[model samples]
Target: MTDKNPFSRRQFLAATSGVMGAAKLYGQGAAGEATPAAKLALQGGPKAVQGGLPQLVRWGQPERERMNALIDQTNLFYWKGPQTTLLIDRFRQTCPLEHVMTCSSGTAALHIAVAAAGIEPGDEVITSPISDIGTVIGVIYQQAVPVFADLGRNTYNLDPEDVARRITPKTKAIIAVHLAGNPCDMHALKTLADQHNLVLIEDCAQAWGAKFRDKPIGTVGHIGCFSLQAAKHVTSGEGGVVASNDPRFGPLLQRFGDKGMDRLAKGGLFEVFATNYRMSEPQAGFAAAQLTRVEGIAEKRSRLGNLLNDKIASTPGIEPHQVHPDDRSTYWFLMFRVRPESFKCERAEFVKALVAEGVPASAGYIPVPLYGNPVFQKHGFFAGRWPLKEQGLTTMDYAQVACPEAEAILKTGVRVTIHEGMGEAYVLSLATAVRKVATHYAH
Candidate 1:
């Protein structure tokens, strides 16, 4: 019978133990003798995974049909186009959001959210240190300070305690990024945002179908931003969407995305000062079709990812991606970390060994925290000097800013992309490869 209760970490561990017991039994010989260990792939042993894994199919009949329908309609423009409306309708059906505005890119969506929140120059927006620079690009463009906050050791999401500490009198908003499709602790963040009277924006670029305690990710924050970038779960080549349930941000979101023009209004008057960041009808058409395919993609990836995690749970020095009991991570890029002291080899060497075993894996994502980037360190957003910094409202220096936990994550974390096509056996092979490499280097 399916368990009605939520799956806690303790329960996961217990289930994993049973699987491990079966594995141990399978390894025993008929005479009750333990079988000899398999040879290491790095030592000329046969590779665990021999063939190419499944690739995500971006274009298909549904997408073609959508495009053909748009072409037949002859309304290529996004303004009042049926394609854009269809995409918006589809997004609303999928996500637990009341309002959505399609934009040119994920960065544009974030910029719109920032503007809709009414972030003024010199205001501070607290966010994750281990994230794409796009997360801060909008904040900096608004002439606001992007205060870096540390992440949790295991979850890899924004640490609520650290967020609380980073808030100052200048703080106006908090952009909580759900990195790698893992949901952040939204309950804690929502509580904190309410207590501080701050705007909460969710950067769910990687978290397309993820849920936090059964609630859709973007619904928790004041404004939730999504990416339809080529590499994301769903893509329109390049596009973005900003969603919100807050009545205050709904109208502002529409106005900001359409260059401050209220398209729904009776008159053609510019009500607010904003730039054009509108998504094309063609992109909208593609995204609408892609949205239909997301649930299947999420299901397969989640199943394979969970199984891989379970198989590798007992591997020494390796920790599977930490997910909350009530949260469902989409696993866009399956990530894990190695405890430095528990292994004889370094992270690079371990990665090399795993690759030799025919498992595709990378050492880590970004080499340094976003603050260590040249643009931020040089204060180079607007011609090498941010206007806010020039005005002397705050003296925060990115070059000197530090997030120790984020730094440590970059040093030890590893990632492998997850897709819908990978089968159960292929996932098992990945687990075997990880176990072989890690066991060989165990201290």
Candidate 2:
């Protein structure tokens, strides 16, 4: 070994393998990362799906076939097709929603929902600062102001108590998000929304099949928005769906996409002031096929989550995000908050070590707090009082609002995949990787 190059490639591989071996000695499950009999016990019986890891593999072939079938039917004249209508009906049934409309993307879905909610210029919409910029962007797109809310220290979801405090006379709506597919406290949020008569919209981008008290997440709110983006549970390449129980908002939202056309048949092909934000038939068809497996996929993820909890819960400096009793969540991303006092290295370094150990772990999902992003700080798009630019949208107030929990998450949270493809073996591999990395830093 030399100072410049202390270990050869072979030596490095050997040392890492040794580290993992030590971790397995301290961890649970199979010695070579196979599914243990104990894990099979969680499946409940032999009747359970046999192929957990391979289901995704099997599903892939069908998905390709459906995709190809759709491509063969595409026409350059317009995006309308039977596949689009078929998917709309399928989603309507799957979610059991009153009404569903396909949109170009999740952002478009959100904007349509906000508009449908009657959020006009200068209206205030409160939402957690820990989420993607969609909420803020949607509010701004509708010429409304977004009021940032704080998240709880325990679960990264928006704190209802904090949301209540943020409500002012100007507040018109509240956009609540189910972060990481964990359903938010809809009861508490609904109570507050009712008290204030505010329109409540559920950002279900991370949650497709999550439930709160046996009721699906998006259904609890007045309106819900779901993404079918590439990485999402139901992939449509780029698509979105907006659902609402209210009859009034449903058709209005439909009009938002088609420029005020009440019906699809009345137009001379583009009568409404609406831009072309319709979902493609091929994408919609592909997503419809994927939707058939959402429930089963979510169940497998839960089983894997339970296994990870059993093996890695006691590991020092590792605290997986706890689920509330009311929430039956769909796992989008498996998250573990690091207790750095018990470890020698930073969360970033720890994530790096886990990646090196063959686990796809990383520090993830840090949002540019709504008020702090360059989009709001420098106002060139909107018409208002631009303090910094001498003429534009009003400058955002980043002061007086703080999110302790969100700040910690934005700075230190680590994440890994909790996709349907992951299994008991993958879960054990992750646990073993975490243990090795934690112990290495502990020393």
Candidate 3:
């Protein structure tokens, strides 16, 4: 018997608990599966590695030391300090964008971008489902609908063809997120966006410093957003930037966050309605210091990723995401594809096994299905709106929008961190652990 009051609190609690329990089950592995704790028991509980492979946490000492030194040199109020200004100048010089506006977080930058595009209530913005929930919320916060398209099987980026299918007269824009710092097929996406006259926003939050063909990533779309969260390629603890060559969009972004005036001189104190999303100077200072070493950092991360890929690819049933011939990947995580057929145990179980072997592994970043996350599925500012409520809306409504490939990828991918500070030795150890686990769990 189906409960008629599906949205009732008790029903909702039970339903949500079930989903979270399932996710945890997959995350921790099923009963009797070789969990990390089990492996630790077998291996005598986390001893020092004498041979086979080095440890997995060695990629940031030198860089961090240098960054700290620079921070110490700066005054407390050095928010828009010299180093921060210099980094902005460097990006502008390289990308030749008309303007760039920094913000407190990537999500904030996304909000600014959405507002700049004039994404009114009920307007639809098409994006990939294989991304963080922030991507979806950014649209919803603007009172716009998040229309998800599937990702290409190979690139894990928004499939241009699916994007075309989802676009309706109500579609105001499309956000193309380059998954894992691998550049999306911008040429194809651009072609589609132009034909429809829709705004093309690049969610380059992961693909900072990545390149498509010869052109840098953020330069291709109408506007580009980069994240500087701790785990990202470049970080100032938590900060973001919105960039665009479009003269109109750039200033609009600044105004969206800065009390709606774009500058202190624009109007009376506390002028237009705005959120305080501005990036602070210390974060800017840290980011500026890191910017000086970005190329070196990106290069090191690429090298470690390549090293792991080379070793792991030799073993059967494991594949890495394909980097297109023209794409220069600044891989944020060392992701290896685990073919379900190749393993005796489930992918989640395999992850626990890897962790047991002293590797810090995870299920990568499985984007919450645009309609699946709690924010969209239940009450939030977005759902409270008259138009959205009138639509009998939930994230489930978005589930009907197609994107099978993205859904599958989100369900089955595992990733390990390969920071810029890691060396070949650490990578080889990771490769050895993955191989050992796969062998033990061979189907």
Off by over 4 Å in 3: 1-84, 264-273, 382-387, 391-396, 399-402
Which residue pairs in candidate 1 collide? none
Best by lDDT: 1
Collision pairs in model 3: 59-421, 59-422, 79-281, 344-443, 371-395
Each model's TM-score?
0.92, 0.80, 0.78
Model 3 Cα shift for residue 153 (angstroms):
2.3
Q: Which lDDT values do the candidates have, in the order given?
A: 0.82, 0.68, 0.67
Candidate 3: tens digits of C-alpha lDDT, residues 1-443: 11011123442243223231222222122122222222332255452122433333423654465456556664543335554565577667545587788788888888888888877777889898777666666787676788888877546788788888878888889999988887888999899889988888989888766778778778999998888888788788899888887876876877786657646364445444668787766677667666656666556665666556545543555655555544566778756667687678888888887776767678756665666655555535443443564675433264255567766766667788877666667766776676667666665
Worst 10 residues of 1 by lDDT: 27-36
The residue-by-residue lDDT of candidate 2 on 283-308, one tens digit each, is: 77777787877777667665666456
lDDT, model 3, position 217: 79
Per-prediction count of colliding residue pairs?
Answer: 0, 3, 5
Q: By descending lDDT, how would the candidates be arranged?
A: 1, 2, 3
